[model samples]
Target chain A: MNEIKIFSPATVANVACGFDVLGFCLDSVGDHMVIRKVEKKGIHISHIEGFDLPYETELNVAGVSALAMYNTLDLDFGFEIEIYKKIKPGSGIGSSAASAVGSVFGMNELLGRPFNKTQLTAFAIQGEALASKCEHADNLAPALFGGFTLVKSISPLKILDLPSPDGLYATIIHPQIEIKTSESRAILPTEVPLNKAIEQWANLGSLVHALHTNDFELIGDALNDVIIEPYRSQLIPEFKLVKEAALQAGALGVGISGSGPSIFSLSQGLDTANTVKEAIASVYKNTEIVFEIHVSKINTQGVKILK
Target chain B: MNEIKIFSPATVANVACGFDVLGFCLDSVGDHMVIRKVEKKGIHISHIEGFDLPYETELNVAGVSALAMYNTLDLDFGFEIEIYKKIKPGSGIGSSAASAVGSVFGMNELLGRPFNKTQLTAFAIQGEALASKCEHADNLAPALFGGFTLVKSISPLKILDLPSPDGLYATIIHPQIEIKTSESRAILPTEVPLNKAIEQWANLGSLVHALHTNDFELIGDALNDVIIEPYRSQLIPEFKLVKEAALQAGALGVGISGSGPSIFSLSQGLDTANTVKEAIASVYKNTEIVFEIHVSKINTQGVKILK
Candidate 1:
């Protein structure tokens, strides 16, 4: 097929206790894109809708990622991208990651799947960098490989896909506030107490075990962030109230989604996820903050081809 | 059964990147203890062999642990423990843990098994604190729960049992130098760089995944210590040379076990573990410091009753 239409989903990165290393895909919200072969040589963002984004090839997240992949291959023809952006930018739920992954995923499909998931993630990270200001594969890996993805290392770019337990779901709340990735990152201390770091890694290690064994209680206990959240949570409105509300409503765990103006709660089932969504929204509604919430299952398939 | 004879195996704690939280049991060497019920109402350290350790019930490692557990119960009879210590004290391979585990395990057997593994670990930590100057379940958990254990939380004492992949073996080298756990701990920085902490948790998370999937190559790559080893390895004699030798001889990964003085290398199979033992021994042979080496399989069973 010369043309492909795909659904590139949003993701929750910096998963509690796993800042900059862990993430999972979302099935509840995403962006749709159509990529097709064009007669000319380079790259083009032919059409766009839903959100205002940079149209220039190098300037746009999708265009930049597609260009990165295109540069790797010596292709005769060019490709054109049509975007239907749905996930809001600066929502902290991997809006840029969706845009980035969509481009290369669609192109790789057109190219008869020349690149592997990790390579596609590398290309997607180039685009992701435009948004996050630093190279991180936490969001991109899950967006490409689906389920839970761990960025084992960054230099050589090692990505590990972890299990998504059955019935696991996520409830995300975007409070319609702006928190830049760089700004959020800036507030974090350059150094953390060694004891706190030990606690963080311990939780992260146990979280992986919880996932593999399908232990929801262990997941709840392990989803603690000792180092990053205490600092960054200050930027979000009513962060503590939202987390407490989510947990009180029976969410397995709750934390800031990424570099948030957004927060996410993970629950064992869709029912609890919906409950958690309503719970967090109730907390946000009391405040002056405008918020939107969505409950989605952990997307096991990552970026998918639309019917 | 009024009397129980047991072999409480050694363990490698602070497993590489898993400082203060992770550990695995070993089968090569350990300590044997015979604990019997006495008509007296207090813990008694009746016999001591091999090591010139204190026989006072309160000061002894095994006795302290037995007292901790004994205090939790309202029992009439007390315990008498006879220790035949084989794993050298200050070897950094859970010598204290084995002794700590042995008393409680044998007593629990005589008392018809009252405590769970986590509870057992908690009591053992009391004894372990006497050695490390801190309460750590890293070594104790593995000895009680078997295989690998992650001390997810220290206060509430949460231990998550991790898998032992088939054919996994350990080669431990005790360089016959003294590095007390408290002194080794004192050398580490109170704080760590945020980036280094992130790298640590990333490796630990991946290491957990590797254990579950039985991915040996991933195990090799993920068995890295970014935070603790750099500081503690300085205290060990020829630490760099030993690690290089282990890796050069096909060991999966090498690091200072628990604290320093003893270095451990993990390999994929029995043959590689043996080879790693030889290589590290060769490196130590050139040094003025004396050394001893032992190669053992991953002990899936923590404390075993002598058949």
Candidate 2:
């Protein structure tokens, strides 16, 4: 009960139609972490492997998120965290969210689950905000709660869990390039055409309906990003080409995963997802940018305990 | 089968957050029309009752919509429409939609159902444009397809039918004031803040989810219209006061039904809907404008055949 080992998952926010409010979790792609009650009075980073992230408690997402949760509970004993990173930071597939959620999820487990999922999300967002320079629960909600999630509102923090239809798979292509979330967000226009806004919301509403009905054609039709993609795609090289290739290769839909540098294509099955991945990989191979492709089923379980 | 007498229900479009794409049909508040196949080669308006309207095929919405269907059919026999009007035009409660839908629905039945709901929506929209000067399917979709409907796209004409939770009721207040739909639409800004757009889409996405899951509290929270209501409310007198009163009376949410002068409140049950109606009626009582209130259950059947 004093120690816990967990696997925190990566997530894809902005599922094309929902810009800052919707996200889905990814299976088989995540970071492993181990946390145990220590004699120290505060959160401590015992070991870090793979990724070269900050070790400072205030600087790192894991340390900061864990501290956010720890500060609330005036417990006597402290917890020590050891992270084995697999997902790279800034890949736009919720690498930071995995760290943010891992610490809180594991700590909560070690503490006999004091806080609920909503509270865990609240704590996780504090660290996620450090990465994006803005508060967004899209990735944090999915990474914490699993499957598809709609960050319905931020003020009262209402997160709606949505169903992920069977056979749905995601193909993520992470280009080895730096695209700061803040800079990418800054490029977006403060105002959007009212017509475009209507179009975007219509697509988002339909996408939610399609998910519930399990209509793949409707899902493909609703996977349009007319508002943010036009602007954010400019930061990722060959985004248009990659998206076109993915669509041509039978992906249900394609868009930048988050702030980008990573592109995600959603398909009906693993075969179509793999086809989309190979098509996207070929597009990147011709370019000077290095990229990694991962195909995974939509993760229904958010964070899992590592046995 | 050669003759049809039908009751076409009124609808509340703009169901708060959905703006141009969402609507729900209303029970018992509509118009009745009798359509029959005649030897004439074109549409004929045989009689008009309860309201003053043009009998000219092109000038009348019922005649115009029926003609639109007839033109495409190229049938040997034409149809005659007799309107027993109950809903007043410019009431902001889909009065025009009732007429537009009635004729097309009746004619389709007389022809043994040649056109589907989408085609009926298409033909009905042509007549509806005579009143609104725009082709919006929010009201038309619900009036034709019944229950809650989302007009997800305009060009391709994608209409998604959504479930109406049990006990859902609508309270509509129509103030005797003149507000043109075109003018009401003109007052809105061409652009909206991106943040506001994001908030709107989030609410809309949540609303869609709420409909699917039958979550009433979430429906209340998600029935927020930040993008369109602000500008359009100025056209209606005491809109804010009426909305506040309805909410205070336990109504789930309130918004301008379609454009202006008429406001609709959705409540959990018939009792709450009656309470909301009384509350809204009280607000308009102090003002100089005359008003009428109608409370009804959410109509799952759009257009019903009269026995």
Candidate 3:
């Protein structure tokens, strides 16, 4: 039985107006996995190295996803899997997605990579579905194909990798507060105002244009999220102050990243990036939430097997 | 006084879901105006060629516009204007916009180009207000800037000239039928469905992206008008067949051009352009409405004063 090892990058979901439709990978934030072929008739799962993951297949997001693929394809291969959880769970980053994607990628490699990227993405999304109890692809997309991506459609899951815009930097602030995906999803209203929806689309359209053209000014102009940001922002403490401070500190723009508790600011230069970090750190001064700041570049390559 | 010969190109307005906020110019189809300085106190306008236009200052669309500019700026420059109207009235090809923009540009040149493009655009929109009875910047924008444009806001009327996407061609079909702007405006519902609005925005956003990227496939996919098209398409004869034929003929897409009777097809290349034109022209084989077919490149330069 040969052993296979793979690494899948971290992802950010619910990118502004895209909600469940858009996401991207982060080369700096991700996880690793290992899969070993076995002669035992079924799959064996072990939760190792600080994952708090259960050994049961039904409860195991990664294991269940691997099993789903096997059942759907009626494959007879038995396997054992282990995951190295790096990104903390409940951090508003795609912590679960890293596990699910790592598992899919690792299993595919163990099985000789028969399935393509799209197929792998579908399997990874199934794993995400087990964890969140909702079929979501926003996180799985970037986890599969790195870089800024738009899920044009979900029926067949048509994903597109946008051009890597230059002169743009990202600063993410992760505050130590738990925000469940279910809770975040529940808070969104099923209906939005017509005028506001128009504005949201306009901004989103402008954002896509800005990324393609590498127009920082347009990107700044389009960062506004009128539909979800205004309503969900209340969940995060100091949301207003953080955004104001980041903008004041020379960020081209700032907004709530994915769900609440964690926020990100976009800067055009290094000086602005530092200012954004300082601004966010200052906002968390009075609270003991324990915050961490990441000054990273947009990851164009998502998940890669590292030894 | 010097005779200033200025030409205002014909324009395509209400670009897809942009409704009243987007437009672009056409090169071959437009109106020509000759403005000669006269020793007079008020502007005089005469329809010299083609269609009949009003001669009285208050009744004439061009004269009223020129008078408005003069009265607003408190300038006492007088001129004699002759309009060569190539774009017919009520053809939905921005016929009156040519007159209004012609007046504004002609007057600006007569006044030594004092007002910039933006200022002239404002005056041109004001003229359209009298014609449409509702303030819209779609037609006037393209008339001023000559290429693809986005009207970001209408409160103070913010206009943006979008990139003229490459490898894209336009096949405009003006069905010789009169559908009044007043009637078209009246049919639109004051309230829109929330979900429909979101879809509209999504399409609008994707359309903008397609334009910026010059992705003709995406442009074709994004040229839908679910909310407005379905309802307004009822007014055009052989609308369904025309659209189907255009799409079948390899047009990236097809849609009503600015509150039609007039329909326009967008193609990716010259072959597709000819195919789309033939497809559209074939539908009018037995219809009484005379159709004028125009194969056009996106006009990057709007109104030019050709001496």
Candidate 4:
């Protein structure tokens, strides 16, 4: 098997109350990458498809992640890569993570799977860091390992795969607008009030407990972000209206996906997910902003090898 | 039944990582309250034993809590209560909570158990507020419900009873020193760094996951307090030394139990709990500060009714 193709799913990070520590994968809308062994000792992007992205190895997340994995192994072999992007960049839906994770996952498979999921995540993070300017596994971990993932600690890179409750569905709306991840992040306050911080942690703890116990009402009650959302939501158009509509349509919770321009809602079943999707779209219907909505179940299978 | 007796166990609040939100009950140390029906229209404390406590129902935590319950129910009858205190107050353990919980639990039983555990916790908090001047249910919730408890929210009172993993043991060291709860609480910073707050919430989320999943190593790694413990540890005698010795003795984690003077360590089994107890005692062997050590399993039965 000298060639391999892998698909990495899009992910939602900072899930409401969990700021930088929690995320989960989406079943659809991701990036596909194909890797083939080369004679040279370095990675190269031989071809690109579906989206306009930098073909330079260092500039691209997929190429950078693949190069990092190859350099770490210090192998005499290399790979030629091709990326078919489906999840658009600047969508705030973990587009970079899909690219980075797909690259390393394909490389690992080509290299006879030398590294475990956690190790693959580290290499993927290195790739993602080149784009995001910081190391965070909230997106990469779920993209690599599938399902809901918790980045417990980033120092030594500890990741825990959390249990996704039954009947959980995701409804996402991507408006045709772009907000840079760096800019969205810069808008946040460096310091939060101590009381709000306490409330945030309490909700976070409750959220985790609710997930484990499968308490839907508790999940709805705990899906509050008292600190980040209040500030970041300003950057997104129609954020409040969309959220209110989603909630009115039976979404258990709704919040901005990643940073902005994209919003996601969680529902208990397929019918509610579709209802939420329509509700979110109805807010943008009369407006000039063009939007796309996707309804999916919680992605249990994260990144997968296609060939 | 006209007369009822109940024992409410002592609890350790905060649990290192979950400040103001998490706590667990202890088995042996508690307060026993006996309540008998009277023809009067109000609650009363007829007798007190083993502690220098006020007989006035309004001033005492036990009496205050019972009175709160009675007032909430608009009861036509009243009860005379007798208290036999075992857990000493101002021990940095939930001594006051034991009293508060014991009184309400006994009254609930004598009233034919009308209110549920969560309702009982609210009454217990009312009782505790008479002493602490604040409503915190970290200790009271665990004492009322037994085992590990998470006070998810204070208003509209949300208490979650967490699972206690098998083989989990607790070792507590109570140095004969008094650190007023108000004083200890006052020493903490009103504002915490956002970075430290993020780290704390991450550890808290991980700790709850560890409890539900029965991951001991994760529990040890996640049982870190970056906010309150640093400042409050100064109030305890040989706090650092005792914590170091506990860790050296194979204890999974060690920190201040509630506020100061009493430090507790969590271990995986009976042997490690005993070893941790001895290691903690060795730190104060030459000092004049008299201390008491108790080692026991996680108390599964919080407050129990004894007829």
Interface RMSD of each: 0.5, 0.4, 2.9, 1.0
Indicate the residue-level lDDT of B239 in model 1.
Answer: 93
Which structure among the candidates has the greatest TM-score? Answer: 2
Instruction: Please give, for residues B74-162, the per-residue lDDT of candidate 1 as tens digits.
Output: 98888899999998998888999999999999998888888887888889888988876777788899988889989888888788889
Best by DockQ: 2
lDDT per residue (tens digit) for residues B53-102 in model 4: 99989999999998888887776788899999888888878989999988
lDDT of 4 by residue, A1-307 (tens): 8888888899999898888988989997788888888888798998888878898899988888887788877778789988888998878889999999988898888878899999989899888998789999899988887878889988898998888898999999999987877778788887788778888888888888998999988888888888889999998889999999999999999887887678889999999999898888999997999988888888888999885
lDDT of each: 0.91, 0.92, 0.76, 0.88
- Candidate 2 has an lDDT of 0.92
Query: Across residues B169-236, which tens digit of lDDT does each residue of candidate 2 receive?
Result: 99999999999767887899999999999999999999999999999999999999999999999999
> DockQ (C-alpha) of model 3?
0.36
For model 4, what is the error of residue B168's alpha carbon versus the real structure, in angstroms, after optimal superposition?
0.8
Chain A TM-score, prediction 1: 0.98
Instruction: Give lDDT tens digits, candidate 2, residues A136-230.
Output: 89999999999999999877888999998999999999999998766886899999999999999999999999999999999999999999999
Candidate 4, which segments miss by more than 4 Å at Cα?
A: B74-76
- Candidate 3 structure, TM-score to reference: 0.86
Instruction: Give candidate 1's error at residue A131 in angstroms.
Output: 2.5
Q: Score the docking of each candidate (DockQ).
A: 0.95, 0.95, 0.36, 0.69
By the DockQ metric, which is better: model 3 or model 4?
4
